[model samples]
Target: MQSMSTLVFDADDTLWENNILFIRVVDDFLAWLAHPTLDHAAIRAVLNDVERANAKTHGYGSRVFLRNLADCFERLNERPATEAERREIERLAAALVFDQVELMPEVAATLADLGARHELALLTKGDDAEQRRKLAASGLAAHFGSVHVVREKDLAAYLALTSELRLDPATTWMIGNSPKSDIIPARQAGWNAVFIPHPHTWELEHAALDPADTGVLQLPSFTALRGHF
Candidate 1:
């Protein structure tokens, strides 16, 4: 029924407004700190170090990220933060986790159309609970055949998913906004990758495509995705 054998989609940013919401919440949290001299960039750099270290073991999600932030705040300030300050920071982080899922433009229509004719799967990297919660809230769960949420998006994880799906890598397509997490790994696993670039993608997720390889495709918008099928 479909031109492609299967389609694997990344949950955040590709299907909905995820990272940008996190960015906004981080900005709010930073403002609440009221540090006049430390700009957002410097503050984020400190936070990034903490997150990267924590992510290796705790994985990605709001809970782990919030904890890392708390740790970073204390380390940067050279003293433990007050309970009230921690609470304020947590409140901001809570908004990101509990907020209603906001679909990108044409996501609903596009998914509905694609679902009718193809096998669709959702793959994301985050804490199991938070990722599942977001997927449930997304209202797009019905469209997917299965979902996989991992602590990391590496070659092993991708291989495991494809093995479970009984998919031929050459015929499967991985679609997402992050080059590091979605595109490169999929391509490395011998799967076709379609990149739907998002402006607010996280710095850690950034990666440049190789010049010689041309199999990877890029779509300007979600609405344009149907044309490929």
Candidate 2:
């Protein structure tokens, strides 16, 4: 709808390889724990447990996940890690926030084109500093008129954006990777939503809904979004 004036995007998986990087690092750490002295299955179980526990307590994002991983490593090893191992783990953990982050193919081009015609905003949830840094470093900061980095993705946050922007939900669309965090909530808030699945979405992020469930639209990629609006 050309008349729709505001477009809000979810920043993490929607635009880049975020959760996948953390999963990769966790897989690497699990491999390291397969040493003769460690129980591989037990270690993996503990890591999964820690992740579930932390998800409830700390919420999502690379920074919080890394901290939980570090604590789990120390507890499982029953001793402080060697300097080399510590450095390695820390490096892997930090990679989610920094390292090599490239925009998904066509994301920049799509956003640039959309920015010219609509009021583009980023509504993301993460460690405030890390999310801001990623947006800035990815060269996406200039395209968005406003960026909201919140601690959690909830009804309140969605409502706040509409209120702050003086936008009617009927004319604002939310584009994101998570059905739970983006699609359902946007629909509930009376806004349209577009779901573009990322390859490495976490289980927590999965929420099933029929295409006819609401006004939420599901697309395979950002490049396909132009035709939807």
Candidate 3:
């Protein structure tokens, strides 16, 4: 087997706690919509519909999620929001930004150790602005030699990165939390994939894969990665 020298990682839930904040905010919004004057199920349905419709337009992140909340409120009330309602939404959205995000224990140490031996890069999918901010805040930014933030993680993106970096797929590994966005595509592109499952990954990010995808390895924690390479 070829020894891996280049390592790529997905941001967001892979390195830090992210989706949990979104889920918490959504749960709070649902609670607020459960008042006597509102139909909880109807409100949830409208929010789901708005999310499905706007997901492509706004993409994933706190901003898009806040927009969905605003749309859901308007649909529920059937009128423009009062100042108080608007303030509440803004407050909740702002709170989501500072919800105590932190790197998983051992992630920083593992990355630092791995970087000493490999060409480490971060390849993530999100709004570039938010992704960059998160990386900078996490203090993991400096460890990576390269970073790529794109709309999606597909075969083309993987191929392009390998081409641009002049990396051999056989010796490159992609580590991430999402099977749909990271593992499947990387495996398809003939790159080694390591799955580090996050506790709060979104349902849409899940994907089924063949058992023969032996190049795709799953681990309970990032600490286990030292042995894989």
Candidate 3 RMSD to the real structure: 2.5
Better of 1 and 2 by lDDT: 1
Q: Compared with the true structure, what per-residue lDDT tens digits does model 2 show for residues 81-183?
A: 7888778787877656463467888889998888878889999987888888888788888899888998778888888888888888888999999988888
For model 2 the local lDDT of residue 19 reads: 78
Which candidate ranks first by TM-score, i.e. highest? 1
Local error of candidate 2 at residue 50 (angstroms): 2.0
TM-score of 3: 0.88
lDDT over C-alpha atoms for residue 169 of model 1:
88
lDDT of each: 0.86, 0.81, 0.83
Winner by lDDT: 1
> Per-candidate TM vs. native?
0.94, 0.86, 0.88
lDDT of 1 by residue, 172-205 (tens): 9999999999999899899998899999998888
Please give the distance, in angstroms, between residue 154's alpha carbon in candidate 1 and its true position after superposition. Answer: 0.8
Q: Which stretches of candidate 2 lie over 4 Å from their true place?
A: 35-45, 74-88, 97-100
Task: After the best TM-score superposition of candidate 3, give how far the Cα of residue 137 lies from its true spot, in angstroms.
Answer: 1.2
* Count of clashing residue pairs in every prediction: 0, 1, 0
Per-residue lDDT of candidate 3, residues 182-203 (tens digit): 9988988889889888878876
